[model samples]
Target: MSEKILELKNISKSFSNLIANDGVDFDLKKGEVHALLGENGAGKTTLMNILYGIYKPDAGEIFLEGKKIDISSPRDAIENGIGMIQQHFSLVPSFSVVQNVALGLKELGIIPDLSKVRKRIVELSNRYKINVDPGAKIWQLSAGEQQRVEIIKLLYVKSKIMILDEPTAILTPQEAKGLFETIREMTANGASVIFISHKLKEVLEISDRVTVLRHGKVIGTVETKGSNENDLARMMVGRDVVLKIDKKPSHPSKPILKIENLHVIGDKGIEAVKGVSLEVKGGEILGIAGVEGNGQRELGEAIYGLRNYTGNIFINGSKVRSGDVLERIKNHVAYIPQDRKADALCGGLPVYKNLFIKAFSSPVFSFNPYLFYPEKLRKPAEKLVKEFSISTSSVDQEVKFLSGGNMQKVVLAREIESEPKLIIAVHPTRGLDVGAEEFVYNVLLAQKERGTAILLIAGDLYEIFNLSDRVGVLYEGQIIGYSEPDESHIEEIGLMMAGVKNEDKI
Candidate 1:
């Protein structure tokens, strides 16, 4: 048997009243890619945090190279050749890659040698095929490039054990493939990796061994070659999980949302959406498929009254007022923004408060002039929590403590419960697990059955083809192609997404 590089025995952790991880055992062999598989709130992140010394285990023993050791702080972990790259990066936007890597190096004196750092970065980048530029600022790089910088930083520290949390959540398919290659290179050089991801397909493709966690206990660990996605899903969720969505044929009614000759400028003072026209009818989903930063954000914002635009936007046959979010809400427009952290929920507030934030003005929750009843808010919140199957202890629990899947559920529960006529859902299931994604699809379909028009903007082609009645491809701020979701039209849609129009190709 190969040498065990790291091991955790009976590891446990808690946050206040929440038992994040029960007695759990995990181990990694040298040069092996060990995957941690679980649903949201399944204690995967908690276990990894303990391994990285971000949290001290309440009860457990850690072993490095067959010798018991203590990892009480990040410095201790780093000293022991362990490093972690979290889902949210820690790089400064304005700093260059080398500078970011050298920020906390104790050995590098106040006047550190920049040339040495750059050379080391280049060496690592070339070794792993990470393809990062040492002199480029963090903000100037794409999401994939930024991820490379994080990996390079870990390598620069001479880490033998790397823990990556949700590494491919925001990456494109091509970018994910590149990252998989880099992982192979790292493992080939005798380094171990603990990859935590909700993507089952990637797990099967990349991991040598997979461990499943549920609630706070270890379900089982299996060799990847013998297990399929079904087996993994069953182990993680404790039940058979549905990976595909089933929906009846869409019977679109009269138009509910109409945009004609819409033009909008991006934050960079350039026209991001140009003369785009589309209509979403009642009881239909119009999915826009495109790469990231292809003006989908601007289009969604313009319709939701969050951005200034020159055009006609009619919701329910009435012209929407420009830059009036509240008025759009009054007209029964519910928008689920792409950035849930910044645009959707207030992290500091309780789940119940966020659930009823938009409904406070309604008569049901208001008691007197300029006053609101807490009891009224609590009742509805309790009902929504139950209906949505949110995994929080109580409605009063802060949303920040919930998992990404649960936070998305809260956003969906709040928006869908309002009985809106028009729904603008942007990457609604971006970071959610398979179970939560199924729940989101079911909710959207239920709303569609109630005659709501939905504009679904997403980067995932599978999602676009799954639920969209009509698919439109957006490229460089233009609606390049439109077609029904049929097998024959997929290749054409792909070409359009790459900015190649059918006519242009001809």
Candidate 2:
């Protein structure tokens, strides 16, 4: 057996009434890639945060190489050869890669040598097959390139223990494969990694050992060689989670939402969505599958009436005016945006307020536009809280206090309850766990049964295949291919997503 590089004994943490971790024990062997698997709210992030010094363990001791050490802050962890790369990149968008890396270097004086820093960055990039340009600004780089910059920062600090939190969540399949190669290179050079991910297939493929967590407790640790996806899923979720969605075939009706020759300019003044024409019929799901940043966001926003575009949008056979969000909403259009924080909910507001934000002007909860009947609002709010299973002490609690899963539930409950004819759901289950994901799928399916036309814009291929009646491949702002979600068409769809044009398929 290899030497144990790190260990946690009797680790426990709590936030008020909620226990995030409970008497957990975890160990990492030298030069080993250890995967920490869990569902959302399973304390995976909390445990890793404790190790990274972002949070202190309420009751625990950490050991490094058989010696107990106290890590009070990230600086202390870094000095002790530990570093964490978070899911959201922390690089300055306006700064170059070299500048971002050099920002916190104590040895780099006020007048630091830029050339030397660039040389070191290039060397590390080439060493790990991380093809990042040191001179390029962070905003100009792709998501995968930004991730490479994060890895380079840890290596530059001489960190022996690396913690990656959901590193592949935003990456394409090809980019994820490259990240696996980079992890192999790191472990080959005698660095241990604590890879925190919900992706089971990647965990089984990349990890030497796997540790499962359920409801803030360590279920068990097992060798990856003997563990399978079904085993891991059961342990993480404490049930036989149906990995595939169960849904009846969608029945087609008249077109509920129609877009013809849609052209929208991105924030950078470039045409992101170019002459795209598609129709989503009532009682059916039209899934748009593509790599992130392939104009999916633009397409969603254009349909929601949030972006200026030259297009003919018809809702229930009536033309929708350009950039009129209220009119679109009145036409029974509900949008579940990708970023829940920025686009959907008001974080500071109470849960009940967010629940009825779309329907505040309605007579059911309002006596007048200036005054709201509290008792009337409470009845509906309480019903939604119970219906969606939003775990909160009171409906008056701030939305930000809830966990990620509950926050998503609030959004789903709100949009689905609106009884919309057209629901534009973008990355609906992007950061949710298997259980919450299942809940979301059930809700969407229920809406489908109610004859709601859904345009599911997502990057997850599994979601596209499982839920979509007809799948369309969006590449470089155009619908490159369209096909039914049959198993035989998987290979052709994958090719179209990579911008490959198959004449026979398209």
Candidate 3:
């Protein structure tokens, strides 16, 4: 057997009355890519936190290369040669990549020489085959580019073992492939990597071994090559997982959502969505397929009244010409934003409070003017959290303490429980692992079966094909093609997303 780089034995953690991690054991071998798999609240984040010295384990023994080490803080973790790249990066948006990477390290009262850091960063990028521009401002870079900066930060710290938390969540397919290749290079150079992902395909492709977690316990660990997705799904969920979204033949009902001659400007005030007209019925999932930044974000924002646009929008046959975002929501339209942490969640608040944000004006939480039951309100909120399988110590736990998948579950649970006439999900399963993805698919299918209209804007072609009843391909501000979900081919969708049109149309 290969040498063990890190090991956790009998590791457990709790908050007040909630057990986040219950007696878990994990091991990583040198130069190995070990994957940690779980549903939301399955204790993955807690375990990583313990390893990274963000949280002290209540009871456990940690051995780094056969020597017990006391990791009291993040500084200690870094000194011990362990680094973690968080799912939501900690980069300063206005700062250049080099500035962001050297931010905290410079304040250690050392020589603040940025040129040296930039040189090291370039060398690290070259060594790992991870390309990044050190001079680029964080905000101007693509999501994939930002991820490269995060990886470089870890590498610059001289980390022997690196943990990547859902590294491919925001990447394009090509970008994801590039990231996997980088991971391979890192491991090939004799570094240990612990990857956290919900995408089963990516995990299977990149991991040497996979560990499955469910309800704060280890279900099992298996060699990636020996087991398939079905086996992992069964272990993670404790049963046979449904792998397909059941949908009936889509027929046009009365149009619940209509956009006529819509045009919207991008974040940089350039034309993004141009003259796009589409109709979504009350009982169908209309999928918008595209590469990222192909106007999908602007289009969803425009429909939800989050952006200024030149167009007409009608919901339930009523004109929403001048409606605001709140009005659109009140009119039985729920939206799940692409970036959950930025758009869907308030990290400072407790889980119940975040849930309250969903139905704040509803009668259940508010009786009338000036009278509200704080404790009584938690009943419904708790029920929703439990039903959705959101992992938290309690409904009162801070949302920041939850993992990415749990945070997403909170957003989905709130929106879906709202029972909206239309649900707009943008990249709904972006950071979720296989078990959580399965749950998300089931939730959407359940809503569709109940005749709720769904507008799914996703970059994942497979997800769009699997869940959508009808699919539309978006290019540079245009709907380039439309077809029934089953009849459409992924290559055709890819072409349209690349702004390629048929020669006949030209």
Candidate 4:
């Protein structure tokens, strides 16, 4: 085994009443890819934050190269040959990759030399097989390209220890494979990596070793050679987890959602959804599979009437006007947006309020039509909290304080209980564990059985195949192909997801 390059001893952290990390110990060997696996609120992110100097450990010691080190800030960590690539890119959309790479360099003097920066960026990118146009604007690049730029920025700083958080969350299968190859190249060149992700398959493929955490404590660490998904899932969840969901065949009814020649303009003022047409029938799930930045968000927003678009959108055979959010809601359209924290819930408010938002203006819950009624919502809110199995002290607790899984349950319970005719769920199970993922699957399937039309846009193909009756591959803002989710179509669907166009099946 290689020498230990980094070590954390008895690490502990807490946020309010939550014990994020409890007396944890972790180490990374030289030139090794060490994967950290855990459930939501299981302290994976918190532990990485401590290593990257984003958070101070309540109790612990960090040792680097056999010597204790103090990492009080990100600057200190960077100075000590450590760098982190966060799940969300922190690059400026208007600036080029070269500019973003050299944004905060004390060594670059008063003015950074643009040519030198660009040359280094290209050289590092090429060396690690992280292809990117340094001069291209961040907004103009795809999600995968932007991720490569982030890696290049870290490599340019000569970082010896790298931390990647949910690195392939937005990447396609091909992109993820390429990323694993890049990690191999980086580690082969003597860089140690702390890989944190929820994707178990990729973790097994990339990491030299795996560590599972549960309930803010280290469950166990094992070699990747003999490890399997079932084992890791069991460790993380403390029991045997049913990875596969039991979904019955769909019995299609009349089309609940129909899009005709829809063209949506993205946030950047470009036509994102170009002449797209599809139908999601009642009692069926139409999964839209795509790599991120391929009109998925824009199409979803358009379908929910949150964004303006050209063409016809019909909900329950009634035309929903473009950009009419309330009209779509009145038409019984429930939207579980991609970013739940930012879009779905009010973090400052309690759980019940988040659930009560949809019926705020409805006459069923409102007496004076414009009056605030907290008491009238408590019973329903408590009922949902219990039904959804959401772990919280009370429904009055702040929504932000709950774990990611519980928060998603709040979103699901609210959307499902409203009994919408159509539900648009985008990446609904983004960072959940296998246990939580199973729960989400069961909820969606129950809704399907209840005859609610669902349009699911997700990056995980496994999820697409598990619940979707029919799958549509969206590449570069168009539906390239459609297929029934099966072993025979996996390869073809994967190809279409990577922009290889084929004939539409449905």
Single out the weakest 10-residue window by summed lDDT for candidate 1. Answer: 364-373
Tens-place lDDT digits, model 4, residues 1-506: 47999999999998766788999999999999999998876888788889889999999999999999999999999999999988767999999888999898778988789899988887888889887898899998877889998888889888999999888876877789989989999999999999988888889899999988887899998999998999999988888988888779999999999999999999888889998999999999999988778899999999998899999999998888999998987888899998788789999999989998988768765567657778889898999988877767688889987766678788988987898889999998876778878888998998899999999999888898889999998988899888888667887887897787675433
**Number of backbone collisions per candidate, in order?**
0, 0, 2, 0
Prediction 4 global C-alpha lDDT: 0.88
- The models' CA-based lDDT, in order, is 0.88, 0.88, 0.85, 0.88
* Best-first order by TM-score: 1, 2, 3, 4
lDDT of 4 at 30: 94
TM-score winner: 1
86-136: candidate 1 lDDT, tens digit per residue: 877899999999999999999899899989999999888889998888999
- Model 3 steric clash pairs: 198-432, 198-433
Candidate 1 lDDT score at position 346? 96
lDDT (tens digit, per residue) of candidate 2 on 1-506 = 39999999999998777788999999999999999988766788888889989899999999999999999899999999999998667999999999999989889899999888899988888888887889899988877889999999999988999999889877888899999999999998889999977778889999999999877899999999988988898988888988888779888899999999999998778999999999999999999999888899989998999998997999999999888888887898999987787789999999998998988656654566767666677789999999876767678888986766678788988998998999999988876777777778888888888899999998888888878889999999999989777678878888998898778544
lDDT of 3 by residue, 1-506 (tens): 38998998989998788787899999999999999998777888889988988899999899999999999887899899999987778899999999999987835356678898889888989888888999999998888999999889888877899998878888999899989888989888888999988777788899999998777788888999988878877887777876665656765577889889999998776899989999899888999988898899989888988888898988999988543887887788999998788888999988887887856667764567467666875898899888887877788889987878888888988888887999889999877766678778888877877778899999888888788988998888889888656634766666677787744344
Candidate 1 vs candidate 2: the TM-score winner is 1
The per-residue C-alpha lDDT of model 1 at residue 144 equals 77
Model 4: per-residue Cα lDDT at residue 134: 85
How many residue pairs clash in model 4?
0
Pairs in clash, predicted candidate 4: none
